[model samples]
Target: MAKIAYILLCHKDPEAIIQQAEQLTAAGDFMSIHFDASAKSESFAMIRDALEDNPNVTFAHKRIKCGWGEWSLVQATLYAIEAAIADFPRATHFYMLSGDCMAVKTAEYAHQFLDDNETDFIESFDFFESDWIKIGMKEERLIYRHFFNERTHKSLFYWAIELQKRLGFKRRIPGDVQVQIGSQWWCLRRRTIESILDFIRSRKDVIRFFRTTWIPDETFFQTLVRHLVPENEIDTRTLTFLMFTDYGMPVTFHNDHYDLLLSQDFLFARKISPDAKTLKARLGKLYSSRGIDFQISNEGRSLYKFLATQGRAGRRFGMRFWETESSLGRERELMIVVCKKWHVAKRLTDQIRQETEIPAIDFIFDEDNTALPDLGGIQSSLAKRARHRRSLMRMLFEYFESDRLIVCMDPSNLDLMHDFFSDRSMTRLLRIECDFTDDYLIGHARRIGLAGDRTSQLTLERLLPTIRNDINHEADRIRDAGFSRHFRIRQSDSTETNATKLVEFLSLPYETALKLAQTRQLFDD
Candidate 1:
C-alpha cells in the first residue's frame, strides 16, 4: 500500500488536531503527529488517548517548548520526520500540515494531483512582502520599544531582524536566480525528505545559524532546497487552496478554524471545521447528492463550469473569425479613426487625408446625442459622458467594416472602444498601462492590413506592430507641428489627457505636476 505521512505541529488546538487525524485515518492514509512540548500535559494526554484506538497514529515522546519566533517548531518537525522515517521506511511522500488547515480536495484526488504535478501542493498565501506584514512589524516594534528595557528590546529586535534576514533575505541560488525563503507547510517526495534530512545533518554550521533565528522552520527547508535543486523545479505557486479572510488572518467557522477554499474560477466552498461533529454527516450527504467523488476535485468542477459558460456566451455573442482575405485589387486600406470629441475626430480625418494617399479614412462617433438633455444637472453630465463613451465604441466597431488600419488618439476613447469591441478585431493607436508591450497597438493595425489575405482570430500578439506604427506616425506629426521637445507621447492611451487637465484632475503637488507634464510631453512628442 502507498503511504503518506502527515507532520502535525500542535500548539493550543489539540482537539482540532485529533479531529483532523480522524479524517486522515478514515481516508486510508498512514499518519504521524508531533505535538509541541509547550502544550499543556493534560491536552497531550487527551490527544494520545483519542488516537490510542487508531492503529496508524504514532505519538512522539520528545517535548520541546516552542516560543513565538523561535527554532523550537523546526526542531519538533525535524524530530517528527526522523521518527516517521525510522518507522515508515516505505512511505512515498511527506505532507506538512497544520491542525487548523483543512483539506479542500478529497484525499485520493489530492494525492493524484500532487503526483501529476510532481510536487507537494502547499498554500503560498503570498503574505511575505505584503503591506499587512510590514505594518504589523512596525507596530509591534514600537510597542516593544515603548514598554521594554534595553536587554528586552535587544532580544525582540534580534528576533525581528533575524526573521527578516532569514525569510525576506534574497539569495541567488543556482541558475542565477533569486527568491526569498518561504513557509513550513510544504510537501516533499520521500527521497527529497531524506535528502533534506541528510543535508541538515551534515551542515552543523547551518543548524547553529538557525538556533538564534526567528521562525527558522519557515526558511530552513526552503533555503536548503533552493541551493540543492534547479530554481524552476521548486513550485512556488503551488497554493491552489486559499483560506479567504478580510485580511491575512484566518476566520473561524462553526466555532472552529475552517477557512473557505476558493476554486480556480473564483467559486468558493467552505472547508469543514475539524472539531465540528456534524462535518462527516453534512459533507457526506452534500458530496453524494452533488455527485462529487474524491477524484473530481472542487477546482476541476469549477473550471468545467467556467469553460461551459464562456463557450455558451461566446456562441450567443456571434463570435466570428477575422476575415483573412486581403483586399485584392482594392484601392483603399480600411482605416478607422476613433476619437472622443467630434472636433478631434475631424482633425484625425484631416491628418489621415494628408498622410495616407492609398486608403481613405472613415470616422464614426457612436455618441447618443438624444440622450443629452438641455437642462443642467448631475444626470445631464452623466448622460453626456455616457454618450461620449458610446461614440468611441461605435468608432471601434466601424474598424471591422473597413479594409484600412484603425487609429484612436485619446486613451479614454481607446479604452471604451476596446471594451465595446472586445469580441471583434479592431486596430487602435492607444496603449494602456496594463498592456505588456508598446507594440500591442501597432500589431493590431498590421494584422488588419494583412487580414485582406488571411483569415484568423485577432489576438493581442497580432495587433502590437500596428499600434507601434500608428504611435510613431502620430509622434512624427506632433513633431512637425513644432512642439517636438515641449510635448511627447507619455502614453497614447485614453487614460491620459493634456498636462493642464491631468494636473488638475490628479490633484498632484505643483512640483510633481510639472515633472509629470514634462514626461507626458516627452511621450506626446
Candidate 2:
C-alpha cells in the first residue's frame, strides 16, 4: 500500500483549514496547502504559525489570486497539487479536500479503504445532460465563453466573457478532451494527478481558453480526468458528504447530523465552524487533532447569495495578452480602423475626418508591423504563436468600446480578416470591406521610383484575378451572415469614384461631407 498525500486549497476559515492539515499530518500522511493570494495577509500568517509544528505539511511557494468560478481558482488548486507531488515522493494516492472538510472516519479505516480498493475516486457527469441543462439553452459552455458581469457582480455571461469566444480571441478546448462537469471535490491516484498537471503545464490552448470562462473549476478537472483516466480504474463516487443550501454556505453539522454524516458512508464531513461546537468539540479531543483556539471565517459557495457574494471576488481575470497606448475609455463615441498592415487602410480613413466629429482609433494586425509579432511556423513554437494571437485579442478588447468599428482588409491578408469580426457583436460593426489592388503596389513603386531604383514585383496579370476571387469569396460569406454593410472596393480606370463610393458605403451622417472635386486618374502622380 502506498502512503496518502492530502492536498488542501484554502481561502477562508483559517482555523478549519489548519485543523484539517494537522489531522492529516498526525495520520502520518503528507499534507500540502495553497492559500489564496487575495486572502487577508495576517490570517494566512496566523494559520501558518498554528500549523508550524506539523512536519508532514508543506505550503505552496507561490500563491494565486483566486476568484470564484473563474480560471484562477483552478490555477490555485493546480499549484497546490503540484506542490504536494514535489513534497511526497512515496505517496501513491492523492486526496483533495476543502478547508471545511473533516475526516469523520478513523485514519486506519480510511487508509484501509483506499489501500484495499484499486478504484480511483472522482465525481463527474456529462454537463449537457437534459436534467442539468435548461430547455432552449444557447450554445453549450464549450462553444460560447461564459463571463462575469460588473454591475450585478454575477456570472451573467451566457454571452461572451471579457475575452470573446469567437475565433481569433478565445482559446478552444482540445477536441480530444470531452465535456465533463461534477462536484468540485474529488480524489485521484498519483498518476492521474500527474496527468492533470501535465495538462496544465503544457496545454496552453486549454489554459488560455478557460482563463476567461465562468466557473471553469467544475469542468477543467472533470474533463481532464475523464478523458485521460480509464473508466475501469476509476470510482465515480465522491468520498465526502455535502449538503447544498439556498445560502452560499453549506448547512453546518451539529450532534444531530453526526449519524447522518456517518450514515452516508462518507469519510469526510464539512463545516466545523464555531457554531458546530457540539459536533466539533468531541472530534477535537481525538489523537492527532490539535487545539483550535482561533476562530476563522468560512466564505462558502457564494454564488448562491447573489447580491452578497457579488460584492466579493467580483473581479474576473484581466486581459492578459496585449498592452495598449491609446486613452479611449467608456462613454465616448470612437471609431476603430483595423487594417491588414501598416497604413493599408489609409485611403479608407482619408474622408472619415471630413465625415465624422468623433475621433477614430487605428490598430494594424499585419504581422509585418512593428506592433505585432511574427506569425511563425505551425509546430516549432506554438506557445509563442498562441501568445501572438492572444496579444491581438487583447488589442481588440482595448478598442471594444468603439461605437462603430470599420475592419479594412487588403488582398494580401484576407486570412487574418475573418477573425477580427467573429467575436464582436454584429451591431457594433459599421462596415467590413476589402480593398484589392487599391494603388498599393503602384503607389509604393511611385514613391520609391523617385529615388531612381526599385525592385521587381509580381505582374498585375498574376495578382489581380487571384485577389479578386479571394475578396469575392470573403464578401459573399459576410453578406450571407446578414451584414448589409459588407462590400468590396477594387479601383480601376472605369471604376466609380473611390471616395464617393466609400461615402455612400459608410452612410455617414455628417452636415458637410468632404467630396473629392475630381477623382484622381489611375497612374497619375
Candidate 3:
C-alpha cells in the first residue's frame, strides 16, 4: 500500500484548514501544515489546538512571513516539507498543496495512482528558452537581485530593477544548475524529496542567490529537481488542477464549481474560496467515502488545455481566423442607417422593421433604449456599450441567414461610427442629415432646456454647427473608404427623396421598399 504525506502552506482561515486536515487524514494519510508568520496568532493557535490530538497531523517548527512573489513562500514550503518528512518516515510520496486545495477524488485513488507511477509529478521546463513569461520581465528575473516584493511595493521594485539594469549589475547562478520555471505545486517520491533536501543543505550560495530572486518558490524546487533526478523519473506536470487569468491571478473555485470539480481527474484542485462552503462540504464528503466511484479520465486535462488556449487568443482580444471571416458578416450584405437625431433614427428603423421580413435593429448605443438583434443585457458604460455594438455587428451574420439586415446607428458616437466606416466591402451607408437652421436650433435648445443659464445655453447653441460639420465630414470619409452608396435625407427634400434609389442602395425588394416609402412618418422631420 502507498502512503502519501501532504504538505499544506496556508496564510489564513484556520477552521477551513482544520476541516481539510480531518478529511485528508481519514484515509490514513499524514498531513504537515505551515501557517505563515504574518497570519494572526489566534488563527495559528486555533488550528494547532484542534489537531493536537491527531497523530497524523504535524505543524511546521519554523514559520516565515510570506509575501506574494517573494522568497518567504519557498521558505515556508521548505519548513512544511521538513516537518512532513521528519514525522512521516513511512510516507512514500510528499504532495504539496495550498490550504485552498481539496481532494477531488478519494484518497485511496490518489495513493494508488502515486504508487503506480514512480515518477515525480511537477512542471519543469528550461526558463530561458520557454515562453512562460508572457506579460512581465523574463530573463531579468534570474539576472537581477530583487530585494522588494513586487506586489506590495511595485514602484520601488521596478525602480530598483531599472537602476540595476542601467548600472550593468547582474547576479550569477551559484552553481551549474539549469534554471527551470513551473507551477509551485508538485508530488515528489521520497527519494526525490530526499535528494532535493540534500542538495539545498549543501548549497549555501544557492540559497543566497534565490533569496532575492523574483518568485523563487516557483523556480527553486523546479530547477533543483531537474538537476537531482533523472529526466525519465520526472513528470513535468502537476497533480493539482490550477488556472490563471489573463491578469496572472489564480482563478478561485466557488460554491457553483461542484460539477466543474467533479469532472476533473486531478486528485486535487486549489485556490478554493473560503466562502465555498457547499463545494467544500460535498467534495469533502466524497473525499473520504470508501465506495465512491472514481475513474481516471483525460476530459478534465483536455478542458484545461482548451480553456487556456481560448483565454490567450480568443475573441476577447478581437482575434479571429480567416477561415471564419465570412461567417462574421464579411460576405453578408449589411446596411448602416446613419443619423444624429435619436427619434429620427428610431422612427426610420421601426418603419423598416414593419416593412421587411429581414432583421432590422436600431440605436445600439441609444442612451435610453439599446436595441440588440439576438443578444440582450444593456451595458452601463460607454466603452462596454461600444464593444457590444461591435460584437453585435460581427455575431449578427452568424445568427441570421437573411440576405440583408439594417443596423441603425447614431454617428454622434464617433468612436463606433469610425470603426463601422473603415470596413467598406459589403456595407452601404444611409445617412439622414437634418437641416436645422440657426434660429430653429437655438429655439429648440431653449425649449428643451439643453443648458441651465444664458452662457451655457449659448455654448449649446454654438455646438450645433460643430455637430453638423462632424456628420458631414464623416459622410465624406465613409464615401472615400469605398462604401458603394450614400443616401442623404434632408428635412428640405425629405418628401422628394427617390424611394427607388434608396431601395436599390439597401438591396431591398421593391415591394418592401414601397411599403417603407409609404410610411411618411419615417421621413417626417
Candidate 4:
C-alpha cells in the first residue's frame, strides 16, 4: 500500500487545479497545493471552496511569491512538500507537479510501479558534465549570485552577472556536496523527501548559497536527491513527461496529443493547454481507471524524438520528408517550382493549370509561413511551420496524392528548395532574376515584410549586388548536380512557353530528365 502525495505548485487557472485535485483524490491519493502569493485572492478562494469538502486535499501553510528562474519556485515546492508530509502521514511517496500538469496514467499503475521499483524517480547528473543546461549561463549559474529575476528583470540579471565576472568574484559551494542539474519535475520517496528536508534544516550555508543561485529550482532538489539518496535506489529520470522546443519553451499538450501522451510510461504531463477541455476530461477519466500497463513503445519514442528534434538534426537534410505521412508505395510525380517572384510564380501556376492537368499550388510559404491555405486540413503552430519547414513540404506531397504535383515555392524557402536539389526522385525547376534591380529587391523585401523600416530597406540595398550572384551560383550548382535542370524565365520569355516546357519536363521520369538536362534543351526560355 504505497500511497502518494502530489505537491502542486500553482500560479493560475484555479479550475484546472481543482480538477486535478479531485481526480487525484478520487484515485486514492493526497494533494498539497501551493498557490502563488501574487495570484488573485478570488481565484485562491474559488479553489479553496471547491476542495473544502475533500479531506485528502490541503493548502500550503505559507504562500510564496514565485517568479520564473527564481529561488521562490523551490520555496513554493518546499512549502507544499512540508504541508503534504505533515498532513498525509500515510503517504509513502511525494510527486511534484504544476497546475497545468495532468495525470496521463492511472494511480494504481503508479503505486504498483513505485512499489516494485522502490526508487526515487528524478533526473540528476553532474552539473559540470551535463548538457541539459541548454540556455543561459552554465558554470556561471553556480559561481555568480543571481538576485534579480531572470525572466522579468533579464537586463539587470545579466548586468549583475557581468559585474560579478568583471570584479572576479565567485561563490564557492558551502559543503562537499556534488552539484547536479536536471528537470525540476521529480517524484521522490518519503524517506528521500525527509532526508532532503533534514539536509535543508541542518545546512543553512548551503541554503544561503542556493538562494542567490540562478534557476535554483531546477538544481536545488536535483542536486540534493543525489547526495541524500543511495545511488542504487535512485532512478535518474523523471516520471513526468516534459518536452521543450528549439527556443527552450515547454511544448503544450492539446487534444490531438492525447494518444501520444497515453503511449508514454510517464505518470503525468505538464504545460497542458488551458483551453484543452476535452484533453483534460479524458486524462481526468484515466486518473481513476485502471489504464494500460506501463511499457515504452518504439513508435512513442520515435514520435517524442521527432518532436524533441524539431528544426534540428531529426528534420535535418530532409530526413523526415519521406517518413512523415508519405505513401511510399504509391507512384506520384513531385515537381517543386522554385521562383523568386510570387507574381511570376502565380502566372506560371495559372498557365500550367489551364494548359495541363497537373496540380500547381502557388505561394506555399506565405506571409504567416504556413501551408494551411495551400494545403488545407493540416493546422500547426506558427513556430512549427517556420521551424519545421520540411515537414510541411512532406505533408504537401502526402496530401495531394496526385499523379503530378507542382508546388510553387518563394525565395524565402531557399533552404527547403536546396534540400531537394540533389534528390532525383522529384523534379525541381528554378526561375530566378539574376539581374538585381533596386525596385525588384525593394518589392521582394516588402512582400516578405522585411522592409518595414528604412533601416531594413537600406540594409537590403547594400546586399542587393550579391543577390544576383547567389541566385546564379545556386542555378550553376543545380546544373552541376546533374539531378535537375534550372530553367531561367526572363521577362521577354513567354510564360505560356515556359509552362509548356515545364509540363514536358514534368512528364519525363528522373532518369530521362537527367539525360535530357545533360544532352539537349529540355527547357527553352
Alpha carbon lDDT of each predicted model: 0.46, 0.55, 0.73, 0.71
Model 2 clash pairs?
69-215
TM-score of 3: 0.59
The candidate maximizing TM-score is 4
Residue-level lDDT of model 2, residues 1-525, one tens digit each, is 657788788877787777767767776888888888878999899888998777778888789876555677787787778778887888888887777777766666666778888877887677666243322232345565655532113224533443464444544566766777767777788998988888777888877776655567777787788888888987777787665432112445555444445445666777644556666755544424433222222222232234233434323211111222112223222233333333535544443533453323334433323222112222124344333443333333332323443433343433444433343333233333434454554454354352213433555445446545654775555546553344433334224344444455555532222242122332232
lDDT string for model 4 (1-525, tens) is 789999999877788888889999997899999999989999999999999999999999999798777899999999999999999999999999988788888888888888898899988999988788654468888899999975444457779999998999987886688999888889899999999999999999899999999889879998998888789988999988876533333556767678778777788887686767898889989889975665555254466556455733342212232243233223445566666556555655555555455666666555354223223323345455545544455544544434557777755555655665534445556564434467776665565575655656558867666665665676665555555555554444554544445445566444433332332222222
- Model 4 has an lDDT value of 0.71
TM-score of each: 0.44, 0.51, 0.59, 0.60
Candidates ranked, most accurate by TM-score first: 4, 3, 2, 1
lDDT of 1: 0.46
Please identify which of the two predictions, 1 or 3, would achieve the higher lDDT against the true structure.
3
Writing each residue's lDDT as its tens digit, candidate 1 over 320-353 gives 1111111111322223333323344444344333
2 or 3, greater by lDDT:
3
Q: Which stretches of candidate 2 lie over 4 Å from their true place?
A: 130-140, 146-152, 155-172, 245-249, 285-525
- The predictions' CA RMSDs to the true structure, in order, are 21.7, 19.4, 18.4, 16.3
Quickly count the clashes in candidate 3.
Answer: 0
* Residue 493, candidate 3: alpha-carbon lDDT: 60
Mark the 10 consecutive residues where model 2 has the least summed lDDT.
317-326
